[model samples]
Target: MTGRFVLQNVKTINGIAVDIILENGKIIEIVPPGTGIGDKIIDYKQKVFVSSGWIDLHVHAFPELDPYGDDVDEIGYKTGVTTVIDAGSTGADQISDLVSSYKNSKTNVFAFLNISRIGLKRIDELSDTSWLDEKELKKAISQYGDFIVGLKARISKSVVGPNGIEPLKIARKFSADTGLPLMVHIGSGPPDIREVLNLLEQQDIITHYLNGKANNLFDEKGEPLPEFNKAIERGVHLDVGHGTASFSFPTAEVAKKRDIRFNTISTDIYRGNRLNGPVYSMANVLTKFLYLGYPLKEVIDAVTVNAAVWLRKPELGRISVGDIGNLTLFSIEDESTLLQDSEGEKRMAEKRVVVKGVVINGEFNEC
Candidate 1:
């Protein structure tokens, strides 16, 4: 087995041109034009855009489970994403099965240990106290700590169903005990937003940051809630989970104006949300940020470096030498497109990009 490949004539997000060389499943060199020869050469002819393989910090393509669907690896390759974090798609009781049957057999997968016992199946049965057993949660974590990167709890009123913050508190305790981060799903909760944010510490994640009218980040007065700032001050990370009902445009506009930055960009790619709003591809999310006045470089960073940092997987999300030889090749197009948010608001993007190819561990495959 030879681990030698060459990527030629691609432009970085910054528009600086370079050639990338991958060998032995690692990036061995990045040189100017005419530096190396290889058995395989991908000449994009300046049409292909190169960036660190996109990382969707959130997704729910649980193939082993019927509810979440089975097209995760295909979706990632098609969308130019090399790695994904399955956000609570499986619960503590079902995680090992999901990991073995779905994650280990296919593409790169990191999961959030669901606070629920049954995971994403049987939505009607998911709730506070009834489905959550912290002891089982700890056992699951202990059993699959390598693949289970963090804790996940949906602290929404509708989801919790009168349990209040008890489930969330339990999740936090488990997270603290396990020494992993907590990824909280915020929206549709009765408790004050500030109080919820106060409980999370630095490196913890607050997903669905742009949801509105559900007692989310903004208050009744439409001002940036103080707890939001406090959480950021405490190093709590914000993520655009972008589910079917999250990512309101008005709130996103506010977030842009307030200069609130995202720690990562992820598609909550589940069965229910893939065809609805925001779409599944991380590149399209980058397009949305571009429409919101984010430069291409910044958008790329959010999906790559930012997400890798959040997961503490330094090997991923970069094209540097000695890094994982993963890359996403895409084409930027100037097209008029209507983008929809959580609230069904439409915004048009002047330019958008599409994934062309993906290289995973030095194997170049078209998306």
Candidate 2:
């Protein structure tokens, strides 16, 4: 994966035409088009768009797990996402294996360690608060600080069965202790959305920000809950974790009209959702946002810069000399393509974002 390479004549989201130069595993230089040379050059003569490689902040790509698992590359390199965070797919008991399996992967894989030590060993990891062993979690965080980017606590009725908000409280404490971000999942809540949002600090995230469930962001009149609005005002980030049952296009459209926008866009993609109707890929989920009328650059930033910033991995979000050589080469195909969100609402996309390939660690991979 180590080599010297150059991408020629590509435009960035901001409409700057530049030649990107890569050496070893870092971007050594960026110059005006036709002004850089390298040992191997990709003459991308067409006006394709280039940007820092995309990051899907909420995907479950640990293939060893059943049903919900998927191959890392399937959701990573193959889908134009260079970095994919496995959102609580594994916990302390299985983290070593999770990290070990991804060491040789072309796609950068990371995780928000599950609050439960058993980690998604079952569909309901948080049903019993006893599963959340602070002792084991602290040890794993200490051991895999670099690999464990954050902590994940699914705060919902089904997952948190009698425990209610205790799991989230534990996750917040762990984050406070380790100085890491915390990702809290919300759905059909026993610990109501307000309770969860009130507890979340600036860096903490609320995934599934827009769903059709009873506990959605909007009130009966389709107004943003005052509690939710205040949380955002206080700097809490809303993430579009478009999962199997989460993400309603009508909800998103309504929120958009209300001036509500998610900080990051993710698919929450796994084998079940990827193969099924809703989230085909990160690109697919991103396309839905485009359908919601987000500007191209703004949509791109959600998957790239905003995602990396909230995940606290500042190193993977930008394109510049001395930055990691992780780039996605893509084009907006001006065509009519059918797109659907998790709620079965459909739209005809005018410009579909098509992936040409990607540069990961200085090695170019074709889609």
Candidate 3:
């Protein structure tokens, strides 16, 4: 049966309170606190905040694939995130397996079909250009276009091997053919980042934008690089893919201080990072951004409306009448908290972002 619920006085990061009513997996109505009508309801009483359902754009949760991957629920509904897009965890050849498995999951799962046919079955999926079979790619995308929301290419020294920029260039051609928004993973670069950034047009996403490495957005003196700024000005989007080795606290802090904002905030959550150090969940990554000085509304927007806009999936993010009833109920707790980045640098913040409950497919679940 479709579950129904009413929540009142759910607090926000900005101290505003909202009341929501969810029915049949869509938001039926939104009214002021204590104004909604329903039974079997929980009067939150101004203790939590409600935002659109959270979307994790970059995660590796194809459990049967690799050790780097994790369970969907561990990084999805269990952590208050309603939607998770497995970033290049599978290629065209294996998407059917993933989609079939995820159909039974409670979390809303999506995928970014990797440029390489084998996906991340090996860390060096892009090492051989032979695996980037254009014919097979088009076939897979055509067959599973619904599940493959976008395409991904990891153009880094380790992943791309001797192919350098050739893999990305090939992926670009495939993106042009399929007309999917390409998500480029920037890491220690063998191919110059300037070339990579220049090739990206508007709507293309650069994940892991704040890596502390010299090859990333920050300059040697910690200033935002001119090339990076130009890329941003060209309407390219920046996403925080806080993976096991990607995020750097100092880099994020410097970017935040200069008002270099992210278009979307995503945790590249998986088994290793989720259970070990660095990224524990999507909330943990969002809290790190909070520590980096992003305002409450901005943080909410990044995961909600902003992400939906970038993904071109208007139905996924937002709380409004007739929209998918995906809502994240959370709180801003004032307390001392210690947060760490991938680099092991630590900082203390007085406020933490906490999850109370989430409204998913019109059903309420505790976080």
Candidate 4:
């Protein structure tokens, strides 16, 4: 794993063939196929499509919590995702432990620190007002400035309990004080979807925006709610945090027909969903988007450049020379694949996106 290496004869998502040369964990050159030489060559022979490494913005990678936890690497590089954002699986009380736990993993990890100090220790983290300790949250963010990307507040009825919109008010204050955006999870709501959307400002994220819950962003006739449109106009980002009960094919199809789209695609992956039914892997989720009629490039961009731009880390999204060499090697096969949504609806896709390997920090690992 030393010296220089060349990933030879790989096609970009747009179908241009190139040879990428890597040295010292950085991309050194990108040239036409057959024009690059290196100490070691791992040739894909133009069969593989390469893009900037995949990044999943929402995942439960804590690995200790029941039902909602998983090992970081298990859902990371092993599945062609070089980076994963643990979406509020930990808060101030356990943020340090979550950081330490992923130190040796091959996948790059970041987190959306839960506004509740207790985090997902209980499913109803924001149920108790005492758990929303601003002092402790500030301390955690100060300690892990680089690791904590934004604040996460699950504004659903079950998560917020009797608190209603109170927790989100506190989260808004925290976001203002901490200078970080919010990644709010929306679902069954008594605070009302409009109340939650109104509280979010520019650059904040609304994960699981396409869920088919009774309190979803669309109306009975599948039209986008006015609040949803306003939020988008305000620059609030939409993320497809397709979890066990979030994604709905009908909802997604309507969104596509209506021209509403995702800013990023993520799997709210955990032990239960990853192993048993929906939300299997990043690739599976991407395939679902492809089946929804999104072009291959758009589907891949949702997990790559679009996500990277939202995170403000452009290096993680493009295959340019001089950037760190992190890329996903996959192929779209001309075969029928069964795609299932969280609501148990199914669609047979004519093509499936399959991961072959990844170049992580200039080193190759097969998926």
Give the best candidate by TM-score. 4
What's model 4's lDDT at 220? 88
lDDT of 4 by residue, 1-367 (tens): 5479888999998999999999998999999898899999888889999999999999999988897899998999999999999999999999999999998898989999999998999999999999999999999999999999999999999999999999999999999999999999999988899999999899999999889899999988889989989999999999999999999999999999999989999999998998997888998999999888899889999999999998899999999989988899999888999989999999999998899999887778888
- For each candidate, C-alpha RMSD in Å? 2.0, 1.5, 1.5, 0.9
Q: Which of 3 and 4 is ahead in lDDT?
A: 4
State TM-scores per candidate. 0.94, 0.96, 0.96, 0.98
Question: What is the per-residue lDDT of model 2 for residues 1-367, given as tens digits with 9 covering 90 to 100?
Answer: 3588889999999988899889888899989898879888887775699989999999998888888788998899888899999999998899888888887688988899998999888878988877888899989988998888888988888888888888888888878888887898889978788888888888788999988788877898989999898988888888999998888878888899899988999889999888875898877787777777899999999989998887667778899789878899998877787987777778888878889889876678878
Q: What is each predicted model's overall lDDT from 0 to 1?
A: 0.79, 0.86, 0.85, 0.93
Q: Distance (Å) between predicted and true CA of 183, model 1?
A: 0.3
How many Å off is the CA of 52 in candidate 2? 0.4
Task: Give one digit per residue, the lDDT tens place, for model 1 in 19-129.
Answer: 888887788888885565777777887788898888888888777666565567755765688888888888887887777765343357788988888887865223647
TM-score for candidate 2: 0.96
Clashes (backbone N, CA, C under 3 Å), per candidate, total 2, 0, 3, 0
Clashing pairs in 2: none
Would you give me the overall lDDT of model 1? Answer: 0.79
Q: How large an RMSD does model 1 have?
A: 2.0
- Candidate 1's displacement at residue 141, Å, is 1.6
